[model samples]
Target chain A: MIENKTNKPQRDGFWEKLSKLNRRYIYMSVGICVIVPLLIRMRLPIFITPPTKSLYNVVDKIPPEDPENMLIISFDYDPSVMPELQPMGVALLKHCFAKKIRVACMSLTVMGIGLAEMATEKAKEEFPDVKYGEDYLIFAWVPGWSIVILKMGENIKETFMADYAGKSLDEFPIVDKIHNYEQVPALVCLTGSSTYLSWITYANTRYNETICTGITGVIAPEIYPWLQSGQISGMLGGIKGAAEYEILLKKNKLSKVEGTASVAMDPQSITHLLIMLFIVLANISYFVIRRKK
Target chain B: MSTNIWVWIAALLTLSVYSFLYKDNPIYRFAEYLFIGTSVGYSIGFLYWNAFIPRIVRPVQAGDYIVLIPTFIGLLFFARFTRKWTWLVRYPIAISLGIGAGISIPLTIQAGIFRQLQATMVGDFTISNIIMVVGVICTLFYFFFSLEQKGVVGGVAKTGIWYIMIAFGAIFGYTVMARIALFVSRVQFLLHDWLGIIK
Candidate 1:
């Protein structure tokens, strides 16, 4: 027992142990927190936020009969961010397909091509009636995203002369009337990077096109100023945002398939709580250890 | 619990990657290398088939001499390999930088500066709007180094610190959520997609 400045006997090594806790213990705790909730499913209520609702409303308003019902979805993320952004992409595709709204899907990054394909495949499994080249078109990735965006603003056909499969864009009736951003009602960018700013800069600022975004949560706060400035029409932030969109889809009877985002929400909530608890515990341990020293 | 070959392969790769959390080992290193190598190979293949062929090779083969000009300029990027011809790389570099700057400056100003200022100034006088406007001014004041930060400027800058701290806290929270979301996704894949333990 050691005496401190206040003449109080020093406590035992609990605080010291906690302060120097093995990282493997924390990892195991996180793993259990994530897996348990996922195994024993719980239906946690998902409240829809305004930004997500705004995005849904924008997509909902596009008339199916309107010749300009085309929506350009840019998948600007890779597998590293696929966990957060893929659900958002799949939900958006499902919404568009259910509403009979045409889609022109493209990836700014080559790595995003696989993710885009995965999302589209997942959505297509639900909408078996939806035919490719007529209902939707997937454009292949090109180098220089900023220039590609600007070129698409001028003429989409010239920018993407062919689809992802090397078929000419002219062969697709979905893009027959969509010459550029003018014919598309809105361009929804799903990104894990700052490429959305390029859309805001080149597409919205240069051509005055409507731009919305579904971004990873890490970058969502940075986009608030753009949303406030009316540069971005609406936004979906992270997996939570994807879950909200899924709720909207089910409520509108647009999708009957269970959404992966909604399914993962319970685990996400539990893991968040566990992390918060760990942070508080660490702080307390740090303070206690400092006092003891 | 799963018989699918692809699922089995994915599960093994995922476990290999997760093994790093316990201790770094050869399995984790192999998985890491595999990921990097595969990503690079995929990108090369995608660019060659989609971009190089469509934009350059096919066009050059079809009697389109105009495409050769840009191709030749792009080829100049390889000049850096030779010391004497390295000066030629500067032409393409300068052309790219010039074009990029020319295209981005006005658009960046319009999207980032003017519109933001307009929104901050002209919005309705709601509580949130007022807070935004005041926060913006205080933050700008915090960065203003012309005068001594002593009087009201100091007070405003102090408030700016609070705003910046709050913003950082929110971003930190979102970052945690993003990371947790990734973990949850992997868990879901293992439980549902691979093991069929969850529906």
Candidate 2:
């Protein structure tokens, strides 16, 4: 006892002590920090940079009703990713509907059906006069994602026998003209995984279909090669990309629901910054302890 | 307060969930448990509505005995909870795997393997495309089984690593930008949406 047994638990220095706090404590503080700012309606002025500008231009250039024009929306994500993707899906659907483009929706993942339905429902709510059969059709989820693309290019009708609502695809006026993949002007993949690469291989390879992607931030890096090599025309990755797409749709005066993604952006930014700071501090502490050793 | 009060309460509970990051305190623990319970409850409800009621019970009630095939398979999933009956789960797994593989591989061949090859072969011949092609070739060749690395082929393979590194760097840079975008979004939320200080 007199010797101060165990050397007082080897008291860590300032930086070391800071690093030793339970990770959950830091996580909780971060949660509060992010939530408080979001609730207060704090937002930064977003500059319309080149990437966002390009995204806007692409959507703008497409005439909403060009008959030869076909837009494919691939729903490859589930409800877990809805908080980030739903807004983007809604915005994209709104833009296509406003333009009067024929919309063909397909799902690779089973959960994607819900997301696809939500998009169509939102579109119908805003564009009330829009007829389902005449304007759009929802393809039921298929098991094989890449094969579905190939089959779509080869024989679109054989691929999707009925719409999600059980309506025959042949009865859908909008989809009546889309017998194959070559008719599609663009393919948009919304996924939380690297299935974008498969789109490249299938659509771009067999059908020569132009592809774009809206994927989660976690899976963004893996798809850059396609983006760089011109296999993909554009990409909207993660929450930030969603916000950017919202700005584009909002600016066009298409839909007011654009605020959903933009509102969430602030909290996302703050949390990221905090995480980066923590990482830097952790690294500095690691180096300091190592040098002392 | 009326029936709509539940919405506000739910919102408050959702926020409380976020509060757990500060510490593993009671509020966070409570929220965590609530989320688990609610999620399980919702899933069970969904299963009953979407799976059991529509697929099994309704079919049985309607005197469609054919539904029993799927009904039996569905019940087999519960075998996962029993150590003795665990092998029964594999029957479903095998069927699912077979479907998954049959669905994915041929299509993957058409997409991931064959389609990628076709793209590379017929790609644009511009300077950027050419560089990309070279990188792709070198990268592909780097994994060549017959080509040993001791000679010029080895040198090219080593150079392939450089190309790969560059590709990786570009991806990394894009990732950084994406992360930065997330950060910017969250910051804007705090400043503009939450505090009304910025817009």
Candidate 3:
């Protein structure tokens, strides 16, 4: 050799190999971890976190007053995040319907309209007596994001003169008593993006509207500061939040059917454990390789 | 198994996307392009009906010619296509930016700064609150470049690094959960909705 390194003999091929493992193998392992528990019908215990409970309690406590008891649910996500968000949307709708609380659904993103319709339809299947014009309505998505929120604060009917079907909102009794954030008890936003901040900024800060969020896991940690500040009344974070809400609904007899979030929890838990194990293994391999060098 | 034709198409597309895990292939590319194309098409259609017609066409048809003002301003955005007329695009851009700033500035400061500061400072003296206050202060110290980071300042900055790292770790964990949840949903569709193998 031209010049042998000081510790050339100390190199371990095993650590080096482990450190250099193919990403495809890890992906396959994750796939297995996700698919296996789902196939085997494994059930994992889902602990209800405080934030989820707070969300449930907030919705539960809304007085079932006529049209004033109405809740505005802003669907701010698309099909891409429907996996984590749609279940919570359905669960919330079911809860609202079960309690006889009216809902006015709208979308900030155009793509959220389909998701909103899907969720409403799914919840409608369970609550057959729920009427559209009387018990709920779907407002067509307008272009502006923050401007829409600010406009709704002034007059909801003026902002959205018609529903999604092009029917005048004045024809619907649901919008008769509900005009702005003043009449509604709370505004629940289901989102996978930072649009919840718009609700906090315009809806809560300006109009004093109570804002609650059901958000994707990626934005969960981001909401804690606002949650602590009482800017957001409650939150359901990630799929686990959905599962917890489902459990709460089941316990309260608001939902009889098993929700998708509840069913997915088994796979979710197992996948999380598997990922944590991989993280540990990768760190161990790196440390071992470094020491050997 | 789902007898619906649409469900079958969706399931096949989902599989096409998953096929990328093995290696990049034409099937994956096809599915990717299809998704992008469909989304863009849907958006354009939605905007035309929901925004263009309702906001501009309907009002103008009803004799409210005032709506044409904003419509004309919006059309100016197309001026960027011409070399000589490109400067006209800035008028609408400036107006929108001015209005956006007017709306966002006060609300942002209230929601993002004042409320957060109040919460951090005026919270009850619990152990968690104490830790949070300290963390906030130290993190602010880390960002204060005016002071030379040496001795006590350096030590506090290092502590701030620990908090920052811990926050990053938590976010990473949640991101992983989110991605896995998406995968689990697809698998659920394949098993329960498509194949009817699970309920």
Candidate 4:
């Protein structure tokens, strides 16, 4: 019922109706929007920007024989963010492993352990010879990120005693000879949350200004200053950033190399366009209905 | 035959999982449950192999009594299950928190607060960098500590808001493009790989 005193349309059933929608309608549409394009194999043109270039350069510029030049892969995302972050994880891992660089994988997020495994698997597929303890080591998921940062900085061994493979860090030649934050060359923070800031405070702060970079989803807004100030050497934020990284890796040719980042792009595009169209239509309808009334 | 059978099984599982988007059907529910079970099982296995085995069992077997401390502390996390013993969980949590907090303080002081301030203060005078520096100063002062100003400070603060808005706007725009790219990638996968509709 429209209130005659006010000119505004009745707001009844607006959100409640949307809330009551049969979830399938939304899910199916989203699924088709995602799946159909995958079946069709669409490769969208990507514009490489400074952020991605900076990320690329960071990886590219790693001194070839600097064994102390280690890259810390911090997984700070969970399955809820799997659709967005997993591809970035896989691609980043593949790049590091292919370059034959030593890596230290750790997770702050509880769910990050599985995601980190998925990344290791992707890298392992290419470099089957890369042993778990020797080539790359995963630190156990540290519960409170801030404290973990402190422990890692103060004494690496006191914070972590062993790798993920049930072997002592002391046993692994690559890891045993390390002490603290100063030994690591670069840190790649892959997250869907703000745990990156903790690293920024705890790890990157103590080191040289240019050693940290990050891969984050799109919702993050506050890190732009860090980017501009050269506090973070590079950043790959969101799926487009991942796509640009893939282009850098030249994975466009491989059939399955087109990972979830590619697959999820379809629904994302259609949904945004759909939302825009609906906004325009609703505005038009509002004007029309108002003018008539 | 074995390889082909595995391929068929995988395809069936994928289809069943994908069916959830259609509706809350049995196939989708089954797949969802399966995924949950598998994930939990995998996690339990990982915890044992990754944490318990190496940190506890092997160390003890190797005759290292020192390993018993962390091993005992980690098991303390399970105290959450017991009503009386639940308070014990705080010990490990405290230790973890202590180390994590200790690391983050000095780091944040340097990276989040100090380095950011320094970077904003000193830089080359390119057009983009200048605008950025201006934005940084105005935004910083926008949260000013000193005297109240109705006119110029307010204007600068207002301009500061605009600068932040514009910078955030660009970030948001880039985010949208990235999301769209992800959606596109998914569609391409379904078309080319699953159905073999495109080459």
Best by TM-score: 3
Q: Which tens-of-lDDT digit does each residue in B10-119 have in candidate 1?
A: 99999999999999999999999999999899988888987898889898899998999998999999999999999999999999999999999999998889988888
Candidate 1 vs candidate 3: the DockQ winner is 3
lDDT tens digits by residue: candidate 4, A31-121 = 5655565555456556786887787777766654355666678888876556566777777776777677677788877678767888888
lDDT of candidate model 4 versus the reference: 0.68
Superior candidate under TM-score, 2 versus 3? 3
Q: Pick the candidate with the highest lDDT.
A: 3
Q: Residue-wise lDDT of candidate 2 within B1-199, one digit each (tens)?
A: 2235555565566557546545457887887787778767865655555446655686699999998996688679899999999999988888878876775666557655554666677766799778878888788789997867778888888888999898676566456545544444544434444445644
Measured by DockQ, the strongest candidate is 3
Over A1-293, each residue of candidate 3 has an lDDT whose tens digit, in order, gives 11125634543366577777889999988889878988897677888998898888888888774867678888999899999999999999999999988888999999988888999999999999999999889998898899999999899999999999788988999788777888887889999999999999999999989999999999999999999999998999999999999999999899899899999999889888888888888899888766654
**What value does the interface RMSD of model 2 take?**
5.4
Candidate 1 per-residue lDDT over residues A1-293, each given as its tens digit: 54678988866577677777889999999999888887788888999998898899988888784556688889998999888899999999999999998887898988877787788899999998898888877987778889999999888988888888888888887877778888888999999999999999999999999999999989999989989888999999988989999999999899998899999899889888888898898899888777767
Reproduced native contacts, each prediction: 0.84, 0.21, 0.86, 0.52
Ranking by DockQ: 3, 1, 4, 2
Error of 4 at B151 (Å): 6.5
Q: What TM-scores do the predictions have?
A: 0.97, 0.69, 0.97, 0.72
Write the number of the candidate with greater DockQ, choosing between 1 and 2: 1
lDDT of predicted model 1: 0.89
Overall lDDT per candidate, in order of appearance: 0.89, 0.70, 0.91, 0.68
What TM-score, to 2 decimals, does candidate 1 have?
0.97
lDDT of 3 at B100: 96
